[model samples]
Structure formats: C-alpha cells, structure tokens
Target: EEASKIVTPNNQSQLEINGGTYATDSWTNVTPKILTHLGMNKHLQQDHPLSIIRQRIVNYFYAAYRNQRGNPLFSVYDKLNPVVTVQQNFDNLLIPSDHVSRQKSDCYYINEQHLLRAHTTAHQVELISGGLDNFLVVGEVYRRDEIDSTHYPVFHQADAVRLVTKDKLFERNPGLELFEETWTGSIANPKRILPSSKFMDQTKQPCHTLEAVKLMEHEMKHVLVGLTKDLFGPRIKYRWVDTYFPFTQPSWELEIYFKDNWLEVLGCGIMRHEILQHAGVHQSIGYAFGLGLERLAMILFDIPDIRLFWSNDSGFLSQFSEQDLQKLTKYKPISHYPQCTNDLSFWLPPDVEVNEGFSPNDFYDLVRSVAGDVVEQISLVDKFKHPKTGKSSVCFRIVYRHMERTMTQAEVNEIHKNIADASVEQFNVQIR
Candidate 1:
C-alpha cells in the first residue's frame, strides 16, 4: 500500500493552481505531470545556472543603452501571469485556428479559451497594448514537447521585443558598436522572412518603412549575435538558420556548435504588423526573439541532459555559485545506472482509427503518470495499418532508468506490469 502510494502522487493531489476557477472539463491536455511543473521556476533560484544566464543576458541589455535616452534598452517582465487566454497565446499572435501549434498535442489547454503559455511571446500583444515599447519577458513556458536529452514539458524562455517608431528610426542609425562584421548574409541576400502556407490571413503587413525595417533587423541580429558570443565566448562557432513562427516574419534561429552538433538556442524575426496594430502600436518597426535557457545552459555548463536541471541532487546543484555568472563548470556524472527497455504494441480503437483522436502526448502523459521521471524516453518504434481489419497498429519503446541508482530487474518488471495494465484500463488500448 505504501509503495503504491509512493508511485501515485497525482491521485491524491488534484487541486488547481491559484488565480482561476476551472470547470471540471476545462483542461484537455494538462495532466498532473505537467501541472506539477506549474510552480517550479528553475530560473528563480539564486544558485541556478538558468537564473545566472538570464542575468548575464539582462546585464548586456542594460549596459548597452545605459547612457542613452529611454535608457535600460530593455525592461524585464519576469512576473507576468503564466495562464493566458487563447486569444493572447494563439489568436493575438496571428496563429490560424487550424494551426498545428494550437493543437492539444503541442499546447497545454486549460480549456478551449485558456491555457498555460507555450511561449513567453504570449505576453507580447498585452504588453504593447498596455503601452510598453522596448522590453524583455522571461517566464516559465509549457509545451507538450517530446521527451529527449534536450527537451522537457516545462522550460524557461526569455522573450525580447524592441520597437522603434518611424521617428525614432529616423533619429537612430542602424550602426551599433557591438555589431562586428560577423553577419552571414550580405546586403543583397538578407534573411528571408517567408510566410507559412498554413496561415490563412495576411502574410506581409508593412508596419514600418522598408529602411526602418532593415535597420531594426540589423540591430536585432547584432544584439543576438553579441549576446551569444558573450555567453559562449568568441571561439564558439554558430550560424543562423531560416525558420517559421506564426508571430514573426522571416524568422531565423541561432544555433551554436556544441558537442559535435548544432544546438538551436533562440528564434527571432521581425514582428508581424498586424500583431502590433492589434496592440494599438502602429507605424513602428520592431524585432522579437524567444530563447530556450535550458539549451543555452546545457552547452555552457557542459551538462549532458535536460533532466539534471530539475534534479535535487546536491552533487548537481552545489557545483555552481550564484554570484559568479561567468563560471563555466563541467558537470561530473554521479551515477552510471543501467537503463531498462520495454516495448508495448497495441491496435488503435475505432475512435482513434476514424477520428485520429490519439496523440503521442496522451501516451507520454500516461507513462509519466505511472513512472514519473524514471521513464526517460518514449519513442514510436513502429506503426502500420492493417488492410484486413482496417485498424492501425503501433509499437512504443519506453526507456526506463533511475538517474541516481540502479534498479533491480524485479522492480522494473513490477513497474512494467503497472504500465501495461494502465494502457489497457485507462487508454482502452488493445495490448498485444
């Protein structure tokens, strides 16, 4: 009984977080596992690497424009509400109703109308609507990301938006001292901000003059590149890749070379004109960016896995000093626990087969519920459709391992039994 109680913490604690009254059916994809991360702001801790990294970035902004008029180039909005209306999170960002990002598989919806913010940009419109021009927004963002060495359901993101009006653009030249001749694109072939075919609405809305927009882009690229170099040093090799985001045009992601691979740290692009006009800020050119702190911290600290950030182990947490922001300490592995692998195959029910109702997130949520953080990764190893029965077959490979200790075969077997039973009972999957 005690062991069962230890394994099932969600059953006992089902209370909603403060600040909103929720109907019984309000949440669709927000499971207890995801909710457990609601209050866990890893960057808030003084000794945390995330907090230090945030401060370092903030300091750069502060120092850059300290003497200029409208000083503090960026005002930090760290304590904004995490729960946002769907309009703010999706609709205000020009995200189409049928966009894949709006799906329950990618976002944690509190209801059809509200959700835990999937990105810090959720507050972009509200802040502009409230009369703020240049600012930085940092907060805990939630998503239904796949489990991996680099991905987690909850992560910290720093979003920065800078707006320069037509008047301001005329006054300020695009040249800044921090900008080195390091931009990959020449004037002829600048970064392309192409519109996604997924968006049904307007693609390119001109909020600023062509010259003003170009200046903003130059400044935006400089700030990002300089900041990255400051964090990782001049020797770090990095490049910019073109990408697509609903809220920004000509989006580009900054990827730094780490551990023999290019790790994407942030995405930035010119803000859509409609987004600004919706917020009552018009006739201005601006740029916005969203960066993942976990990915940045991982590379800087030589951390191997994303789960270590959440670990309470003193061995992991005690290595860094809060006061020393530039200290780059390599994390030493504390345990070499053996990993156990389990495979489960099942046939989709009629509801799933006909309506495409089943999502990998549902299965991941279930695994997290039963196994907690012990379940490291879940992969869809195989999938096929049966012509005779008209049912889809799927197989998932679940990797289980304890970070701090080795698990006996007996214990793994017991947990696997529970997982199999839960799939049948809870998910109504026909286990084979």
Candidate 2:
C-alpha cells in the first residue's frame, strides 16, 4: 500500500550521496549496485556555467531560512520541504494529470518521460499519511512560465498540508468564530456556523456530507490563518469560485484580495476518492493546498518584477530586513471607512431572459468594476418571479470598505445609485 510504503522503511531503501553511488546503507537484501564506467561529461545533467554555482548559493539561503524558521515567531511559514530521489514523483495538485497544464507546451518537459516539477504542491498526496499536524513542503520549482517583471520560468513554491479530526482543539471551539467576526465582509450570522459534510472515515463507514465538509473547510481555514498570521494579519477575506481538478472533491481556488485585484494565492479542496485509493488511505478525509513564493514575494514587497527573484540582485533582496517582517505580526489596519452593506432587488418580466438585454448579474459585474477595493461582494441572494410584480426580481447584497475614513452613507449611496442607474438603463428594469 502507498501509505505503508511511506511510513515503513522500504525493504529497499536507497540513498544517493556526493554524485557518486547510491548506497543501500542497510543490512540483508545486500546486493551491490553493479556499475559500468560512464564518461565524465555524460554523467552531468547540465553544462550551464552558473547552474552549479547558483545552486550552491541557494543552498546557503535555504539553510539560513530554515534556522530562522524555528523561532516561535516564524511559525506561520507553512513551507516544509523534503528533497526526493531521482525516481520519486510528486503528485500534481488541483489540475488533472492529462490536462494541458501538464503537457510539454505548458510545462517544463523534465524528460521525455518526466517533466520538471511545477509546484511544491505536487507533494500533497504523497505526504498525507506522514504523521504530523499542519505539515508543509517547500521547494524550488521549474516550469515553462514566461519570464516577465512578474513572471519566472523557475521559481519556488510552499505547499502546506493539514490533517484534523473531531478531537482536535479547534473542534472544541466549534470554529474560530470570534476570529471570523472581527473581519469585515465576514459571514455575519454568529449563529450560522460554517457547514460540514458526511463521508466515510478510514474505517469505511459512510459519514461525509456537504455540511461536514464546510466545517472542515472552516477548521482548515482557521488553522491556516493562525499559522500564517505572522506574515499576514487577521481579517483575511476568502474569494471562492467554481474550478475543476482531478485529485480533489468539490475543488475551488481561494483568493484573498489584498492590494487591489483579487490576488489569487492558494488552491484547496477535499481529496478525491481515486487519490485516497492511490495513497492507500482508505476511508479518510484529505485536504491540500499550495502557495507560490514568487507571488507572495511580489505582494509583500510590492515587487512588480518577477524575474528579479532569480536576478541574483543582492541589492534588491537586501532592501528588506527580516526585522521588517515583524510589522506583519500586528493586526492589519482596516480600511478607513466602516463597511456599508446594503441589499437591493430588481424585478423583470418573465419574458425577459438574462441575454435579452441587461440583467442583474451584469449589473453586479459593473458594480465590482467601479467599486474596486470598496466592493466586498455582490451575492445574488434571492431570485425568482415576483409574485405581486408579475416580474422576475433578483436580490443582491453589496458591501463596501474604505481605509482612510469611515465611508459616509452618502459615499456608499453614490456607488449604490450608480449600480441602480446602470440597472435601469441596462435592461429597462425597475429596481424594487
């Protein structure tokens, strides 16, 4: 079983050392690795001049970072990486294996057989059974990504994995309810807890369900937030959208809006049945997510240039001190204005199909555009044919944020008015 193979020392344990030979380093099953002499240059993977030199430099940086990572203050790091042997493969996360994201045109072709690693997230399935709470993997990743000020072919990824059960401390509180409420745009109903699902546990008993799954999501979110609080403060916002993936069940990408646009960060979901079977983890729940170092560096440092990561530009990196990161530990300053939340509905003729002219969904899109950072969310909370109006009406809740000063009702009203005006002009629909 895959799970057995991971935890038990392989009957065939192999370790490669010093560019020489792989040593069995074990008793019994003692078989010498038969070798033939291969020419010098043929033995090396690349002749690129700076490859070896640069690799050594990165090794030093990694060493220093790991040491600093142990400090109690640095727990939010979440990036835990372990190197793999030549024959090892890290499973791809979120995306389907047969997907174009896995094809040569989109990814680095590692070999005609195996391609360079795309993200550290590939380690998800493999490490699920490893005995650890909130484990993680961090490593250098190679992809064919276009190089730009904000792009790089070779970058780093930090993959964080967490496993929890009904017994954990988080289960006692039922969730970090207090934490969720403190943030604006958070789900306001204090009594309305995150949902869960019913699914089989490792025992093959039928138990998972949508409600339980959401509870797990909430639990994981709380764990991830607490762990990552040092780098990013409290009051994080979650952005969810429909997305597809092979190894996950009900997969979705989660983005948190920070500077301006929704800065997509991590991907997560419950593990797929096939994935659990492959991992030999029967009747168990699984969750996994990956974070891109390049993206985090950009957001944290306001780095518009992605290539700068590999620039070996000492000047660029030296600009920020480890000390500066301490500021991140504090709660992030809220937007100047208190959030203004309002809900509006529109009535349409039953004959009016969304495509016939303008619609409520379209109006919300425009609301999102003009509202920008101010637009917390535009949810189509209610929609149906109006019983009395003899028309279809769509109800939406809008939330706005301001950073400098609390947004006056008038300021919010102005934006609301624009949304209303656009709706009226859009489909000749009346606002209810």
Candidate 3:
C-alpha cells in the first residue's frame, strides 16, 4: 500500500496545523514544503533516532537530579506547538523590539501577532506562569535559513530551565543550603565566566547578588557537564566557550570534539532575573539552556547530512532503532548524483562597502525562494576592483543537486535564469 498524502489548504489566507487555525497574512514566509513538516512530531515518534536521542538526554538529567538533589525529574513537554505570539517568542525573552531576527526574511509570521516558534525557549515563560519551576520542552523550531547539508528551515531544540533560590529551597525542604564561594576571575576563564557583550550588562538583574549568581552559575555548569558526559560517554573531549543570548546572562556554549572539530552542542547560562520575575517567581534566580539535538544526533549516529532525518527511505533510516541508544550506526550513501554549477557576477554600488547590500545570505534566500530545495551549495568564487570606475565586482558559484534523484539541465537553466534576474531586480546591481 502507498503512504497517505497530506491535503494542503488551497487558501493562502490561513494555515491549519494540529487543529489550530492561524490567520495568515502577507508576511507569511513559510513555504508549502515547510508546511508539510508541521505536526510530524518526529522527536516524539517511536523509533525515530532524534526522538530516541532526546529521551536519552532526558534520562541522564532525570537520574542526576533524582540521585544528587533528592528531587524528581522535570516534566517533559514534547509536541508540535508551531503557533506562538510575538511577545512569547521575542518580547518575553527581552529581545529588542527591532532585532534583525524579527525580520520577515528570517522568521515565519502568521500576521503581526503570531508566528511559528523559532526556538523552544519561546514556551519558557508560559510554563513558568503555569507554576512549573523545572521542565524540558522539546519541539520543532522554524527559520528561513540557507539551504545546505547542515542548514534547514525547520529543526528541533531542547530547552530546559530551573528556578532556584535559597529561600525557596529552605521553604520546601529546610535542608538545602547555598554554597558560599563566588567566582572571582577574569572573563577569559571559561569555567568561571561566560562570554560577555554590552547586552549582558544591560540585562543583568539589580536584585541579583554576586554570591547568589555565582552559586547559581556553578550549579548550572555542574548539571550540564554531568548530562553531557552521560550522553557522549564519560571521556568525551569537550570545551566551554563564552556566547550571548537575549534571555540569559553570561551565556556559554558547549562544544564537543567530534570529527576532529569542535562542534557546538548547546547554549546556556544564568537565566535573566527579569524572565523569572515576569513568570511570577519573584524570590528566585534560575539558569536555562537550549541545545540543538540534531547536531548531537548527527555526531552520535554518524548521520552524514541533516536532511536524512526527514527521509522516508527505509534504506537510510532502517539503520537506527529505538531499542538501541549506544549503537553507533554509520550511515552509508545510497547513491551519488551528478552536480550542476552556475555562476553570476555583479557590480557593487558606490554608496556602501564591497560586501554590503546583496549579501551571500540574501542571495541564498533568493535562490531557495526560486529553486526550492534542489539547489545545494553557493560560494563566492571571484572578486575584482575596477581601477577607473572605483567600483568592485564579485562572482558567486551556485551548485545544484538533488539528494534522492537527478535534475534535468533545462530545469537547472530555468532556475539559474530566475536567480540572475531576481538578483538584478531585487538588489539593484548590474550584471557583469
């Protein structure tokens, strides 16, 4: 028997997902290809390797908290909640109103008020408002990202948070005590301080004390280290790097050594007190982390490409089974297809830098918009400066290949023509 085909709505005015209807407007950038991924809940499905990996991480943390802190594990919220308000996704996290991430090119908006959640952290405040102090929310997030082996428009993130305060611990158990030592070192110390930006200072809570924040930061690292070791094996080589995020102060990212490179696995730090305060937890400080599970799974399972997670081909997916977590199954390539290449060069306007308006990313987005997923890679191969005109010229090479099948030269030529025309019309640059 053949698999069932999904019925897409003919109306562009609204989108229906998991029984919820969102009013679609002109700002909607979600493509029909991406809409099919909604409600698939691959992370929650049985036998899905991504889902299995998520469960393994949850298990590791659960056991750690239970044994060390004498507290039960957090409740798991794994579902497809694509719809969230603008306030919840950006405003709740204290993101600036004019942040570039809020742009239509980078996000999928269902009107001005609602959008597909871009990160699992989008649901954090709602959980806190509902009286949960600790929880793990695993779900799909949307982005209008560039097309590549590693970049996809939709992916999964696991966001976990814990609210802590000395008073709350004493009130609940009367036995737990806050540690006294505080970190006193330069920001260069990866173990002691997270990477700082101007925003970190701007967002730090006035209610926080050096001692309290130090202890909370220490606890956050301890839990994350333990969890990481459990999932990647005890002797796994990893390092901490300073990073920045809107919702967390002194944010750090965890990078694990894999394939002879340091692959960033997660981003975390001391939770901004403003977030907790808005959630009605006025008496506590907390820490939170959001990690991309697909990146980790790619390393663990030796999955060659991010696109394989969406494959229905039994040959590609049958290698993984939910019954096994430690089984490292190396993915085998089914077939390699021929590649088609195209190049475009354009002149830069005098008013801006050589790299200003028609950025590589903008060009990539334009290519994906016209060619869909068939276009694989884009590269800036050549550049030149005209001595007389004082103008700069740049050339880019575009690679086109389909994962499962071959593409006709006619189809590729049409896409190339469209991209060239769009580049001229949209970016206002003369073709050379």
Q: Give me the candidate number with maximum lDDT.
A: 1
Clashes within 3 Å, all models in order? 1, 32, 0
Top TM-score hit? 1
**Model 3, residue 207: C-alpha shift (Å):** 1.8
Order of models, best lDDT first: 1, 3, 2
1 or 3, which is superior by TM-score?
Answer: 1
Instruction: Report the candidate with higher TM-score, 2 versus 3.
Output: 3
Candidates in descending TM-score order = 1, 3, 2
Candidate 1 clash pair list: 193-250
TM-score of each model, paired residue for residue: 0.87, 0.46, 0.79
In model 2, which regions exceed 4 Å deviation?
Answer: 1-97, 129-133, 166-207, 225-230, 235-238, 328-432
RMSD of 3: 7.0
Error of 2 at 4 (Å): 47
All-Cα superposition RMSD per candidate:
6.6, 21.1, 7.0
